[model samples]
Target: MEAGYLFLVGPFAYTKLGKRANADTMDRITIFCFVASYTLALMLELLHSWRGLIAARIGALLSGLAGLVAHTLFLYSKQPPLIWQFSWLLFVAWVLVVAYLTGAIHYRRLTWGIFVLPLVLALVGLAVLFGQPPERGLWTTYETHTLWGPVHATLLLLASVGVCVGFLASIMYLFQAHRLRTKATPGTGLRMLSLEKLEEMNRRAIWAAFPLLSAGMIAGVVLLSRSEVVSWTDPRVLSTVVLWLLFAVVLFLRIASFLRARQVAMLTIVAFLLLLCSLVLSHNQPTGG
Candidate 1:
């Protein structure tokens, strides 16, 4: 009886220890892990573009998928993960990676992966610049739990994703347009969507972004009115307003036919630049007292 009990307990202890070890390994995963994976994927994409190898395309897809899995696990490992600049940027990058993977798989003929992967790498690099969270932490549990807080954050995140989509589409439009104007060959197997489709993508992304951004701003205002910790004169608020105005201007120009597609693409790129600035300069202040 004693021997049997010892055997049972030994197995249980070993299993528990194994789980703990796995958890620790996951927690130990650094941003560089996924960054390197994504970089590898991007390089594979470039290789495919240059050589038109099916093997390179397959390798790129696998690498991207691996990076995404690592990114998800790393995010899950965060202790009581809170929404803030560093984590938010990571989340955005993760979303874009998912989008890239989906598009790459679905539209195998298009060279969107080349354009999108660079942006993903840039976002990850920017997130690294924000570094780790402080011991004291920037946001309290109570702040994030507030009624309007999550709503506002979710909308803004979606809006950011939309802006990124528009930015990419505009870039594709410009490239396709330039290629057409110069009558350049589509660079080996590097096929792109026509200018019309690219323009439509840009327009639809902005159309979706405008309303989401507006709703997010409204929710933010409501949160501000309810919270003593937030103020109207915050730079973040002002920058957000400026960002919205730029979007509005772009929409008006696109709708009014005042600016051609090429000009609209240029303005969309400008908005994208501002969006990057806003993301970089954004502070993770406490949402409520």
Candidate 2:
């Protein structure tokens, strides 16, 4: 049972099984309930795209809220009194879903669902597949116990969510751009955010996310500086540095001149994908000596 308190300080788990953790011990009903809720919500959103129905919007809202509630319950059930196993990347996914839900309610815009739900589904899928309970004989390393760990974690998580929201906005921008360029009529079922608003959101997500991610990477670099347990040469560290630089370029270009909105959107997508890959590499690290 001691092995089960996996993320002592951080929200990551490392083990020898490598590719993905064994998920047999997880709570299936909670998983199923939230997954089904999000899936149904996504479907309703798609239906709105096709039919332009307000009822579909209402259904999607209710479904997203239900999913959010189930997600909270799932986490609560796993988090024993003071023990902090809340470090799963799925927790990031949950935050994104909650943010998406919040955006849906605040904006009252169905198009938000079109671009955001797929990513939410992907994050939830990762949560389902790899968010397993640690086994009795599991090989592991705890990254959360240090003072800097939670700060490192919170910044990275916020950055990731910001990038994700930005990504969705980018998709929206592209959709809006396409319609504008081709003079195509929006389908009766689809209502998109204005190009101006989508562009603004894309810009805001990056402006906010890049600095936080960079700070998180810097904190890790500081940790490596004070010890020899891990190397700066580690793929995770190097890739994040590289990821930070890439976004820095985006941030610079975004602020400097007439960098087209389309280019900025594309860059954000690339940066997010790179971050995802780095996370996958970190997730699969061999923890055994």
Candidate 3:
């Protein structure tokens, strides 16, 4: 349990390092170590569930340490390691943990885990399956004058996370709504938020995320226009434009339904689904991938 807690803490500590100049290497190494540790711990827990062996527990702890050492060695040898990739992984892990811990989701939501884990596994699997390649010369053509690219990416990622929360909220809302409609007592294992509160939370998350997403999309367009490497006609570019339009229309409809909170909540849910679909499509696209 302590080891699992540490595994969770490591990623957040590394994220805080984003503010410092010499923090890149340390942050990357920390994230690599944390993932490796968490994976080991999870494997051990699974084994323990299966075999009920003390040695398996010990193996879990030792594997975690071994992973840390391996990651350290890998980082030491690579020149100017690609830190951002590691950071992204850490951030995603942090969000998942937060979601689980908050009771915003229940343990039975392992099905949700089944949905998200494959994506995370695919990313980590890609990293392990393909060794790091040599760094090419600085692609100045891709660089833009706006310092906003990183900000935009960060905010968009945050907004995406918020949308995920909204998704969960919607699920809970629907579950509770169903119970009310049928006059069924709530089940013991699956606890859900009050319909009113869930709706409030869903609406708030959308309201907060919309502005950040809008800013990110606008800044992204500006940055791409200034960057010679990116073309306006690129499928990736067009997809983003389409996504933004969808979100914008959703936003407009949500605001128009100011008097009807239920309508707003439903619109938020629909918008989040559209955004998620866009993300999946974009990620699967050759240019975006």
Would you list the C-alpha lDDT of every candidate in the order shown?
0.76, 0.69, 0.50
lDDT of 3 by residue, 1-289 (tens): 2232223223333433235444555445643564566575556645654565567656654654455454443343232222133333334444544443233134332223222333334445544433343332331323212354454556566666666666666666776777788877654323455788878777777767778777767767777767666677865566656656755675677678643655555655676556545444444221121
Superposed Cα RMSD, model 3: 9.2
Which 10-residue window in model 1 sums to the lowest lDDT? 2-11
Ranking by lDDT: 1, 2, 3
Best by TM-score: 1
- RMSD of model 2 against the true structure: 6.6
Q: Summing lDDT over every window of 10 consecutive residues in candidate 2, give the lowest-scoring window.
A: 79-88
Ranking of candidates on TM-score, top first: 1, 2, 3
**Comparing 1 and 2 on lDDT, the stronger one:** 1
At residue 162, give the lDDT of candidate 2.
83
Best by lDDT: 1
Candidate 2 local lDDT, 33-96, one digit each (tens): 8878899999998887787788998999899998888776566545421111223455666877
Off by over 4 Å in 3: 1-90, 103-146, 187-189, 258-270, 273-289
lDDT of 3 at 72: 45
* Residue 237 of model 1, lDDT score: 73
Could you give me the TM-score of model 1 versus the true structure?
Answer: 0.85
* lDDT of model 3, residue 149: 45
